[model samples]
Target chain A: MQYQSQAVAKLYFTAAIGLFAGQILFGLILGLQYVVGDFLFPEIPFNVARMVHTNLLIVWILFGFMGAAYYLVPEEAERELHSPGLAVLMFWVFLVAGALTILGYLLVPYSGLAKMTGNDLLPTMGREFLEQPTITKIGIVIVALAFLYNIGMTILSGRKTVVNLVLLIGLAGLAVLFLFAFYNPDNLVEDKLYWWWVVHLWVEGVWELILGSILAFVLIKTTGVDREVIEKWLYVIIAMTLITGIIGTGHHYYWIGTPEYWQWWGSVFSALEPIPFFMMTVFAFNMVNRRRRNHLNKVAVLWALGTAVMAFLGAGVWGFLHTLSPVNYYTHGSQITAAHGHMAFYGAYAMIVLTIISYAMPMMRGRKAANSNRSQVLEMWSFWLMTVSMVFITLFLTGAGILQVYLQRYSDTPLPFMVVQEKIALFYWMREVAGVVFLAGLVLYIASFFVGSKDPEAAVEQAASPTA
Target chain B: MTRGGSLPETSRYPPGDLAVWIFILAELAVFAIFFAAYAFTRMQHVALFDQYQATLDRNAALFNTLALVTASYFVVRAVTAIREGRTASARNRLWAAVGMGGLFLLVKGMEYAHHLGEGIRLSTNAFYMFYLSLTFFHFMHVILGILVLMVLAMRTAAGHYSAQSHTDIESGASYWHMVDLVWLILFPLVYVMH
Candidate 1:
């Protein structure tokens, strides 16, 4: 709102929410396919639906990050964006390319899509999570470059704050590491090794810097805390993130055809991955407690805090549960991995993007500082609804994972994967129910934006100083 | 900014930047979990651990321990010198600490070369995996620690810090001490303890 270019973020956020709905819908379809198996059948198979679900999630979150950067960087730098036009252009390019890719996935078989898209030239398709054809991947790279040029130039030309610097570094790292996704090989081990350079390095590595900077930016605005204090802690937290996370890449190397040494290296470093999340949790609470004045955006504050705790529980705690090689040996590809993936992605990335959107959306829409109180209350309800449902989703998956591990991997006579899955269908059903609740929560979340638009903005009350 | 006044109660203020303390606590947590994993794994394979523990050059580890301890002593002296308004002496002490750190890395590097030359690798055995993993991880910390000390030394020599304003010095020193502290535990657990 402070800068004309900041309005461009509204387009990106609106697109993000739209794709988020698409992601959850596809997620529910995939969840149903888990139990009913033939519900979607040949029309839209589970694998294709899953690809849409996950790809949508990634695309939407990228939109959210781009939107957040567009909104926050100008305010932090105290300048107009270098080229809002480039941002809008790249946004359309990314969205159209993403949509086309999803359509291809639905319309054609994956192999046919690959052949049609000339994936044989690059052959980056068919891998887990990097399933986009080579052409689309190239398009992604081009879009990323333009986006970075726009943001990076703005930050360099304006007041250089730690928040902006960290965010730029994270965004740059994200773009650079993503190049590894293009480096697929016939050597499965080598492919897997570098695949992590993209995946692990993004989520656990640079993306954390993005997450921290955004959290810091929000905390500084909402709590009226000292920027210096938050910025300092930002450096410390991100330093810990890379310190543990860089070597922590070894965790994925284990059980792959990598050397036995990775077992120790991976186990030790990754077990410590939770440290930064724990610090993040503590840092969020401590800053809020030390607030000079409470801002009227209570839901934003709630999200900032919620992101911390849930990230710790979902990414930190659940991750550590199977991070050690011994534990992973039994649980590697089971529902446990799925369990961890669902919650960790939702908690860490999905929630943080939502946090920034929650904070910035109201401002972009001409509110003074916050949405109306009724809107905030409904948003809070949505928060609890979505968050609590996610917790149950994780728990139910964990339950399924534990049972699957026992019956399929550890029993006196180990059962086959399908046989064990049949026994654990009940957990999947419960998980599907939980997924429905999550969708309902998403609906409520969307409703929150429209419910109180015409009402007066929420007012801040000067409560007694809790710290004093 | 002067610490010349009665030092703030430890209850009210931690010694270094609060930010650095948070970093320190995170680092400690990682090391703690690692040590616990080591202990748990060792309990399950006492004979294998003992067999490999014998192969380690305890004398080199003992020497490295002395180097780190002496380096920590030098860091403590540097902190004291800065507090007393002796920037030159503090700089000299930090340089001396850096030298000790260099000695530690040099010795540890030689140890690594010896092992690699012997064709022993991480995949050689479970025992070697833990030994090399833990030691090499700590070794990287030493290198990082030295880099920090070198920065602190340069800053001190340039008169960037004072008795009143030396949080950077304290923060760097705190990190170096942590590196040394982890080694102290690491040396005893992985190298000496039966």
Candidate 2:
């Protein structure tokens, strides 16, 4: 690594991958519970498994973003980190708090865990995705502040580049919006209203800034393109992102007992939400096509390109499928939301993290640019295995969603939720099988790291002509 | 400064940065989908749409249209002036374009105030929802377009651009025209069309 502080990213990335494996494992458990309802029984129920699954995904992705920022910020700013010591300290703090939270979820009843963690004093528990205890949540805020202080100070003191600036903005927004997680009023409607300020605003809003800046950094490094060209596009893309995404928050307001006008406003604006993803897809391919040299990190390039296409398909196309208020009337809170959530999260956040790790890991490990060919080949295999399995998982869920909607919502004589779920058990079975394949892919992905560590770095074909 | 000879062959492509063009295409796609949605919804509630369509201030809308079209014309003249090595004229034309944008926003703001005073909001009715949503959305674009024009004008007046290297001017103009173009479609689709 060019900077000593950049090496700290290795610890965070390794933790991220480990937690990702945990996420997939819990995901498989949740999938099984969907079919064999009593498989885990009282020992580990569906809700606990789900909390573990989702919480792990969130934690791991946070780790990935933090790791990515730690790695790229120094390079972009043309200086060493301001405080590597602070970064390492925060890493341990976040990991321990996250682990304790997960263990509490698994080892104790959620209510018991809540009581133990002083939920009565400040109850932020029992909420979707904000299920962490009050203390853990406070710890998270503290850790985030320290982390930001270190990274923000480094960026401000060093050469200011668009990549670093945009990343800082995104990270700052993430921390700020997360404060809403603490403001849970007893009014259910108002609670749901601001809940989206944290969830929706994070993914659809500022997190996109983080995603775009990282993608730009990787493309600039690998494509040998002019930084000015990439940076210009970065500005325009993020401008469109906020312009559309801020108002796109209306989509979640519908049917939440807020106001009826949100139907039209949400439908109109959220439908436009896919535009930025489409632009992101075109941007990734356009830059790669216009590459000045073929970098040796072929797998990183694959990941960067795959991130673009999959994010478009998963987040853009699937998102647009039910973003309209009329369509959402039938599909809201159904398996379709689950289907979209799985793929969109995987494609946009998960894949982007993996993309950055794939790009940075080799350099951190003392390789010139890339992994050995055998390792890369295995990694590519894992990519297709995980990606294709995810597509099938989404498709199976979509099938289940459509059938559920037909039976439960749209029929002249609608069936109850349980009755329809039992009827749609076959699709759930298919989803479980796909989930297994996804786990296998994760196993192979982990194996890729150890498989060819002894071999020499992958050689580049210098004579191969670059083609768009 | 030298002119024309240093410029790349841009005949086969759109003016300004390729990045801005991509952004323009994305914006157009969004507007296209929104318009299609509006048309489909209008078909479903033709009576309601027609009723609300009558309440709109067509005079103000017409005035705003003239302002945007004139602003676009001025933007074109500014680009032309810059191409002929006339920074002074380009700056003037750019400021004139900004002034036209200001006029559009002012007229549009008055229309919004009228609606608000009449107790109309996005929650009022389906027709009002679409009307306010479309017009207000276009209004924000006008403000953003004006910002771009002002930046370009200031930079031009400060002699930061020349005939040989004025991609920023071209890019800013391209975005302004897109804002104007969307309004042209929006004006008839929402205001004039029954």
Candidate 3:
């Protein structure tokens, strides 16, 4: 009944390291491109590198989710997985498909790729990274299906528990949302319209379910909080998510020419989206405060607690800053949106994934206690780096977004397109530097997973300590 | 961790049903918000919404409403039958509930199809948006309810529920009742009152 799996954990750990390496390399390339324009424009073009960087963030977090599902499902059900082979198969297929998709991005020039795939050529919008093609889009569907099958089979055959059921519903929602990829809206405005289905719904919708289930799992393990307490929290979180998030899709539709009511609809609902995250913060800390028995994964618990607070700030407070139609009118595509995106991803998804990994890796290795001083130090370092760098990134982007919006959107200044572009270029460089610092934290994280603590006595002492 | 204070089973109910009740309560909160939105949006454009409301056949909605109410009645009877040790009769009542629930959806779908043929679509206006969103969301829950009933029916056929282990029946009935309650609200808000 242990909530850990060695095989699945290893797959995710490996994916995380590879993805982080990609992140760091692309992070550097992206940063340099802004400072010295036309520098290395041919090899690892800005568009390709940026796509790889953003997508890698998404891929690694998914890797984390897969690992968590495998670890938690069997334990919650009190049975072994229906098929470990299927789980392993899903890992390899997704990894290989992910690699090929990235390789495809690198091999074809943006225009050439569009031409080869039969898209009409136009001036690049400079968001080279967001050009998701049909094949890669299909690849995501396949990955989601494989995960659904594995998790579905595991749940159907095992005991039905509230925690496991809630978690599976969340995962199922992820699969359903991924289906949005198949819909290729012909018009640009309509494309961005349905774009919210995948982006907004997944993160704001199903992702809420994921966060709730993960938090419930951690609390049950670490605090021995009553099953009733944890299950109720799970239900409330998902309910809030659905209530706020479904209509909250309106926020994205404000500029997409859908309807004007979304301005008010989205404003009200999204303003309330932070309530669950704030509740999550209280849930984690409150459970810890009332722990019946101490557990070994304190750092993991710390990350879980941290994810809630940061997610509320990043996705909630910061998102609200530009969510309303009035504010969003100015800040729509500015660096301010970029700022919200970075903190929200790291705060909500990144930390939750890390929490699952931290909690499970030792259990997977059959370690009886938390890791020693070195691993803890590395983890603490990881936390600080991601936290500090993200804050700075948000700061620079907010300033940049405000400036860009004022000059480009509002002002009738005489700055030419090229000149204005040059004026607002420094913020991109700042973002690149922040991304690098975040990458360093990621590298330390992957290294710690492999060469973890070897000091058993120290680990035991920490585990025995009440705070753990 | 085995406590001496655990509740004794009151006839056919088990403690796990408590968890199911708790889950139902949370679902009600979510549905409440959607209902509130439906009401608020209706208020925003009362004339358009009322015009759209008239487009819906009141007789059909009244029938659907009656069907759901009857399903709830049958489900409650099923629970009672199971508690009284009439397993076969209980299964019949549960099946009757399922059939009624299925019938309600079929009638609702036909109504939607009729309306759609008249050129009423999701993006037609705010009224249609709420009409489609609220109805479709409710339809999804109806599907879920049917699935729950199917599970309970299968279990009952396998002799899983009895006078002493019919918590499943209670939970299933509780959910069906909720579905009924939601429709009651929907009947007035979206159909008659508007």
Best by TM-score: 2
Each prediction's whole-model lDDT (CA): 0.92, 0.92, 0.76
Best prediction by DockQ: 1
Worst window of 10 by summed lDDT in candidate 3 chain B? B8-17
Docking class of 3: incorrect
lDDT (Cα, tens digit) per residue for candidate 2, span A401-432: 99999999999999999999999999999999
Model 3 segments beyond 4 Å from truth? A1-6, A111-140, A412-418, A450-452, A457-468, B1-194
Candidate 3: pairs in clash: none
lDDT tens readout by residue for model 2, B135-170: 887788889889999999999999999989999899
Interface DockQ of each model: 0.71, 0.61, 0.09
Determine the iRMS, in angstroms, of model 1.
Answer: 1.6
Q: What is the lDDT of residue A421 in candidate 1?
A: 86
Candidate 3, A334-411: lDDT as tens digits: 778888987898889888887777777676666664665567667878887878888888888788778878777778
Residue A461's C-alpha lDDT in candidate 3?
60
lDDT: the better of candidates 2 and 3: 2
lDDT of 1 by residue, A62-157 (tens): 999999999999999999999999999999999999999999999999999999999877778888889999999999999999989999999999
* Local error of candidate 2 at residue B116 (angstroms): 1.6
